[model samples]
Target: MNNKTSSFLWNFRQLKLNICPFGSTSIRRLMKVDPLKLHKSKITYQSNSLQKPQSSVRNFCQGVLAFQLEGNEIQKRSLSTLTSTSVGKLLNPRPLSFDSQCFLMSNTTPQLAEDGLKKITDSVEHDLSPKEKQLDFGKQRDLIQQCNSMSDVLDVFSKYPRFSCCNYFITMWKIAKNMSEDQKRVERQLLYEHPAFKQLCDHVMKEAKIVRLQQLMFTLYAVIRIGIPQNIYLVQVLLRVVQERINECDETSLSVLSRTLETMEESKNVDALRAALRLLVDKQIWTIEHILTLQTMMKCIGKDAPYPLKKKMELKALKELNKFSHVNSQYMFGALAALNHRSLILLNECSKMVVANIHGCPFWMLMNILQSCRKLQYQNLDLFTAIGDYVTTTFDMWKMKQVLAFLFAFETLRFRHIGLMNMFLKRVLDESQSLNQKEILCILHIYSSLNHFHECKNQEFLEVITSALNTYLPKISSLNLLKAVYCFCLLKHFPQDPFNQLLQENIINELLMSGNESSKAENMLHQVNACLEFEDTSVLQSIPITLKECSSDSFFSNVEVEDVLLNLFENKRLFLKNVQLPHNYFVDFELRMDSKRSQVFPVSEADVFVAKPDILRVALLCVPRSAFCFGTTHPRGGLGMKMRHLKALGFHVILVHTWEIKRLDMNPAVTFLKTQIFSQEAFPTATEFAA
Candidate 1:
């Protein structure tokens, strides 16, 4: 009870310790007893009520060892087991018949290989769940339908996950080889209507998930092979989607955007191209280095290709360029300059077509081209000449006026050509014939800016201007008299000598008459003064008489006739009596006669003659009042007294009264006394005055 039980317990504890290090007691339990023999012994013991299992346990242990050895041999033959024996040890110990080892290795190899291959095949074949299989088939059919609806169904299929990658590409290649029109149409419609197509595009773009490049190539091929139309709306939507996708900072999105740009270029869908360019500019997606490519695209789009479409494309290109606010103006300007040069070339090329199809090319088109050139600061002299020639030759007078106005407004003043100025003047003069004073006024302003006022005097030019002025002046309301005055001033300076005569007789006198009570009179006076500088005294002499009749103090007030008087005195040593002088003399003097009455002597002989009281006032004010009558009136009859004093002083007086005054006051006593005071020959006859 003590030694034997203790020994058994000690052995069992040692065995438990051995198995404990192996991390499990199952091996220890197997070593302790055979479970099959124990089960059989237990069955016998249960039947006989006794335990007798020693022999059975031995046999069971032997059987278990044999089974384990066989399993080890099988594992080694299949090459699926790792052994602790070294390679040298295993080679020397594992001595078997060559045929037996080869046969065993061969038998195990096929079964392992088959099992591995079957597992892979089964995994591939059963990858989709029941629900996924249905979904995949449905998606495949949907993609096929989409491809059939559109001629370019590959664009949609390549965008679908179920059809994208290897699947869509292989299918697209097959469809491309055997494509029918109906099939192509159905594919295209399917693509056009597929919602997942856009989603797939967005996913590839946003996630940068380019699982395959072949799909893209096939999609592009299909688009081109099917011949994409110039559908602006479709292009716009595509461009917007591209823009949104490109904003995601992904390689796939950029690749897609770039590919779209290239496709747009090939299609010559300039509107789409411009739309892409505008997106680039608006998004500022490209770095400054990439702008060169953008600019090149812009140039290609703006080239003159055809009619409304070309114009539409060009305008869109210009608008896109205008969006680059921070772009280097010099770069943009250079690009625009190149574009302008091309435009001019195009204009020349199409000019003949425009002329032939006159109704097709409206004046606005030419005007817009010219305006664009100007706005871009494109100043080519040859282009300007061509434009000028076109305008002058093709446009009527009214339209010519608009063209000239644009030229005058926008063309550089420093570049004003003399020939252009001359042509403009001639056109203006001709066109202005039917124009009202206001319009004429504008023409005059342009002439003035060109400094062409003196040019009107050119005989040929004068005829046109005079005709225009004469025709339009009467119809113009008095409110526009100031403008007429400017025109008159231009006419006054024309180079023709006869213009001077006409001015003196007609224009100047009429202007002076019209200016009598109008505020415009002062301006007219200025013009009259300008003429006086030319020393055209015919008008000057008429001015004094006109002033005498008008009784306008202000009129006399403004006229600087002292200079004229001095000029006349210096030139002719002559002065007029009883004629108005401009107010404000720089010098004043009194003349005295030696007598008991102390009469003021005349400063000059011309100051002593008189014709009427108003004229007398105008002329006598140049000298002191004592020189003529101090406080005398017409009834006082100072003429006789003055003549007697003059006769006593040994002077001759001219009886210069008007015929009306002479006929009324002719008394023989008074006449004889006036004759004694002055010689009869001193008085001129009315016939001489008329002459």
Candidate 2:
């Protein structure tokens, strides 16, 4: 395509995107002018369809996207140029134009500014909470919106002493958001020393007691969007005020406020936010009426939100899923993400919705659905194949972190579509220069987890990761470094010369002394040592950490399931309980039989290890509900790996998921076990023994 035609077609792609500011209004092709040279190229709106009733015409800038005013609302539209720079970079973030307090909810959404903030809607404007309803003074909002300069903003607040905290907040954001970054950062500067900012903070703090729910919510939000210029006092005050009036917040305001808290990077503020949000969820969750409100509540609860709160939300979400047809696709997707995968019914219902809406989901949303599937351990290849077909074509729009997340999810689910894997790996290779410490761990983990030991496909990435890790070794977390070493062992491609830096005294001690990971770290040490012994090519003079001798006994997470299985074996001598194996692997029960495998007899869990019982071992793994992913019956990566190693060591595995015991009576559970142990599928290896 020629440069002119290419630029013209780019407009079509933008118009096609639902997130685009122009809607369907951009590609009407009302008029086309001859291309002017370089930056002079422009598209002017001449048609009445582009104009608002009783409003003046608005023209778009030639090379940048700008917001247009129509009626009482501000709308986003397009103007394009085939410039040297890309269209996304050419656009600038629109200034604050909220009818409510959504601005703070999206600043940390991992999107560039131009994505969605340009078009604010009026739907979320809360009815002023009961206490502040009397302070809705006349014409204040209109006059403030009309102000064109900072001086005008200051003058309005000065004129109206009765104006509520809402007006005060609007003025603060208008003035402070426009200030350039350099002005805010210097140690001692005129902007920092200015009294106007201090005055704004003082007024908000003064009126905080009677501040409308709207203003308080947005006040907390604005601190996240653009921190108060030299005003930490305002943040601390806002937090204190939140605890007092937190229950006064309506459902939508509460959701927005909770989302804004996730963007707070400071640990101190995060702890406070978690405490408040958790308390509020406990108090208000029972009273929520609207389904969309529930959806917002589910979406706002971040990964760090209380665990019991997450369980409560999932129970509420599953009840709300019957109303899924009435919900928006985005809201449904968001609610579906919070579901615990223990319910196949929920996963099945949600997957139907997912497949139906798969083609319409954007790049990030699709990737999020996949990540949720990974977490849920939902390994329906049909769902994955459908998403893979769509996302593989729109690969260019994916951000680096999203790409890393998508690849990691694919590997975790153990669903290796050849084309999808190739596309993700190629993107990683193309963007290798930008990999950070965590990203390098992700890349290496994806590579090894998928068992991509091929020298040709994985060689370049390993070389890049090795060079990157050597630089990033000290920077990576102790947990992640251990995971990376485990990945190295999985691939058997550890670069001896560079990664020997992993065995440094300080690093080894950090790995050994990982507090919460003390038990797991011992397993990692054994894994690395086993790999080192097998490879027989050590750059290190000796193994770094000494292994402590211990019993190889595996314990059951759900002991009730074991009791049920024990009843099935009527003869206690027929089942060996909790046999621990090499490399931290454990089977709940093991049985040994003759080589012909005619009859099974119980061997002592200890005595079986004296001989090669893995050859005739009929291993029964009692996977708890938590061991499976959120919705599917499939075991998660960790348990699946244990089962895989058991099979590789010559055991014919018999599986028992917790649902079998939970959903079935003792008779049926016994029947299920007999079928699993006695009549195996023709292709047992091809089953979901790994996933």
Candidate 3:
């Protein structure tokens, strides 16, 4: 028979002997008397075995014999010890009386066996015992009956050394799961009810044996999964356990610990991990010391070992070492530099070291470090040389990928890395043929962020950017075309003439036609245009001349700009009701007379000269002024004092400032003279004017 069959048969025999102690002998005889009759006898034996226990083996034998004698086709058979062990044990040290056994055996019945089996099955199914059901219904009575204190639970769990094993863990889990609602409430209360439970849990966690430590780790995982408040303590206990296990050189323990650490990572429980690390450090755990020693050992292993094994060892060492300090600022740079120099041959080893160590530091901290480093080595040719050497050497794609991401991040924040940034950009652009859309987008985004378009204005760089765009533009998907357009537009006006004609002929028109409505891109576009002195005169003329294009449709479509301006004006009106004119408006404009106009006309019917007479008749408004001063060479034949001298010329002269007099406050003809002046000559220098 197969092992599975053998095991099943063995368990079945044990059960039979336990319930049918007195009937064995008679059943054996029935098996022998008529071998064909043994089948019915076995069925009868099974039926009786399912109920209450028989009183004695002799009584069971008598009952079976009586049944056989009644022509029940009894089959006598030898009693196998396989089916008799349980009954034999229970019947040991019995009274030496055959009659007592016979009475007990005769009384055994299938009904009693059935009832007994049902009780046992019910007990297992409901997790209820007769004693438990008899307990009180009130809260105080319930608490008094059960013992589910935190300390008690910990004590129970601490006794099991093989807690990490599946079987032991499942059992304990069932026990906890079986607790009533009241019991669970008591459990929680006991946990935080007093300082004693805390002390006990702490002690148990610290002093837990190896197997118990494994169990503790599982428990911590469970607690974390359940989102229990006790996770803080659990984390502390698990970290200590890991430290101990690592020191012991227990591979199994390390495996479990590694998985737990990864779990913590996946859950983003950095705070808990930090707390655990701090506890280990403050306690001076031997595991950390051992880890440091192992790192030294790996260094001693040098480069001669097999690459895979060496990588594994080195990675293990780095992971442990990472727990010693913040990864990004403390360890990541050195690790990256080492890999860059070829001192680290394995890319996986380098990646693990970098990822593990770097992630420990805050993102802002990493950003700060990168920024500071970028500025320090920005113009250094050696840095670029090193990067190029590293990127080209070994062809390690993983390291290259990480470096690219890192550089992208640095550039994204507009950190200074001039020499390396330029080199990297050149390299990437050169390899653009092989790059995917996502990779291209990342590069373009970083380029945009660093304002690298400004550098593209140089003749040499302009060709490169133009070439890249020409090659990639058609390949770029429609969704990303808008982004590429913005980047290209930025480059078009980057203050150089290498591509000036190309921009004016094609790129500018493309941008104007594309009509993207992104406010951010538009704003940036406008800034670029203003920086390069590109004026969108059509949009400007629509607004009041007194308002300057502080920011306007140069960055947006006419409709979008108008909507935004309307909203802005609405908000301004609501928030700044009393604020003054030009200060209140977002844009400001200054007006001046054309320098080339030798003669100017007043706003009158005669002065309204039509450039397009067939189009429409226009009227000009006029106002009277006080004084007009003419140049010494002026010829005489003027009809009247020309308003050009009164208003167009820059001078202070007196004029009557008028408004309608109302409310009977003053005489209607009382006119006040306001001194205003005009001059054709240029304003004096500061010194002359002051004098």
All candidates in order of TM-score, best leading: 2, 3, 1
Q: How do the residues 474-497 of candidate 1 rate in per-residue lDDT, one tens digit apiece?
A: 465443444444444443333233
Which clashing pairs does model 2 show?
341-630, 341-631, 342-630, 376-629, 376-630
Give each model's whole-structure lDDT. 0.38, 0.58, 0.35
Indicate the residue-level lDDT of 534 in model 3. 32
Q: TM-score of predicted model 1? A: 0.25
* TM, every model: 0.25, 0.55, 0.29
Residue 223 displacement (Å), model 3: 18
Better of 1 and 3 by lDDT: 1
Candidate 2, number of clashes: 5
Stretches of model 1 off by over 4 angstroms after superposition: 1-366, 369-380, 389-433, 436-439, 453-457, 470-484, 487-691
lDDT of 2 by residue, 199-257 (tens): 65566765665557767877777655645432254665676566445546787677767
RMSD of each: 35.7, 21.6, 28.5
The number of residue pairs in model 1 that clash at the backbone is: 15
The residue-by-residue lDDT of candidate 3 on 38-65, one tens digit each, is 1222222434444543444233233222
Q: How far in Å is the alpha carbon of 605 misplaced in model 3?
A: 33
